[model samples]
Target: MSFLTLLRRVAMTLLFILLPAASGWACTPVFVRGQASTLRLNVGQLTVPADARPGTPLYHKSFAWNRLSDGGEQWIRCADDPHGLSPLLLDSLLSGGVTRPTVYQTNLAGIGVRVSLRAIGGYGCFPDRPTPSPFSQRVDNPAALPRCGVETGLFPPDD
Candidate 1:
């Protein structure tokens, strides 16, 4: 092949490689429990008090995620459900690009994050109840993303 053709092919290859990292939903809060291959959780900052006890979840920064994605995710950082979630707010967060305040709160410090999304089934974690509990539930947001509970890929975006 000619030099021009070779250069074009190399350029295309490089684009594919670097595109993902660049296109990744940057600046958005993602807490991957691998609970579900594609169960994308948009959560808030976790505040575990210095005097808090073990085996007890102080309180998670109320997270939200929907199957819809048009742009970036809007997360409420450091606000631990200070005010109850209103129906309107819930609907907005569960609909499309989040429009809430911008704050950074990633809490993946000691938690394990599953890198693959092709798991046969989703990781069973109870969002309503902490682990080591007798209760466990699957991702069931029928009203929002019907397919959010299904696992399909092993990478970021398009999972």
Candidate 2:
């Protein structure tokens, strides 16, 4: 039992214990009644709005995620989204970093988000929606995105 070997064992044990907790603590948005919900990310916790109302705008100035990594804080909002989706927080979870914006539909009964990516805009429950077809069968076009019965004329940037 060398001192260096003991140190290594302790480090490995710490890693094994901390890794799962780190992942479990990762920020995730909260949804209410199948509608888009907002969350606040602090040091190591995500806080969901206590008074969230259904169908209201999900993103607000105070609630928006501030990109503090850069020199100064920049507020990411829905209206000026270059990516076409608002609230910006839900982007990665919903899209899975895919080129096309992933869509989830709220159930007819409005119980929760459906498992299927059947339509765009979370079936209108989501605040943002891409425009109807102009992009067709291309890797970099609106047509590539899933089209649904309801369209908002909003589209993400090409490629």
Candidate 3:
């Protein structure tokens, strides 16, 4: 079967096994490999917009994928379905289509399993804007903008 198809199957199985018990937990479980660290984490229900260039992928509604490393939580936003992971994703994750997201992972949702997230293209491409700005402040730090092409390893928006 295709990767996404297989992922869906896996997600369903995981949901059947995990959600019944962990339903009360604040986050859901998701598995990952080859990341050189923890493979599983509790995925939360919270979702926010994908922080990327306005017209970029994942610029739409995005879901957060949580990972616990060194006993701390790290969040990675993801895209909606058809990318492998549709299960484990909160209802909000599948609702919106804001940013244009790059297919970063084959498994986009499917928490409580080894599914990857595709809406996760907003790494360094998203700037960290300082101060409390409105939605207009979509980009990250202005000074850090240069880092996109240099340190952060991202191409210019115009490109």
Each model's lDDT: 0.32, 0.32, 0.29
> Number of the top candidate by TM-score?
2
Which should have the higher TM-score, number 1 or number 3?
1
| Pick by lDDT: 2 or 3, better one | 2
TM-score list, all predictions: 0.19, 0.20, 0.16
> How much does each candidate deviate from the true structure in C-alpha RMSD?
19.0, 20.2, 20.9
> What would the TM-score be for candidate 1 when compared with the true structure?
0.19
What is the alpha-carbon lDDT of model 2 when measured against the actual structure? 0.32
Find the 10 residues in a row with the least total lDDT in model 1. 150-159
Look at candidate 2 and tell me the lDDT of residue 38: 36
- Ten contiguous residues minimizing lDDT sum, candidate 3: 144-153
lDDT of 1 by residue, 1-159 (tens): 999999999999998999888844343332212122233554344554566443333333322334333343333321333222212122233322443222212245322222111112332221332221111233322122212221111112212
True-structure RMSD for candidate 3 = 20.9
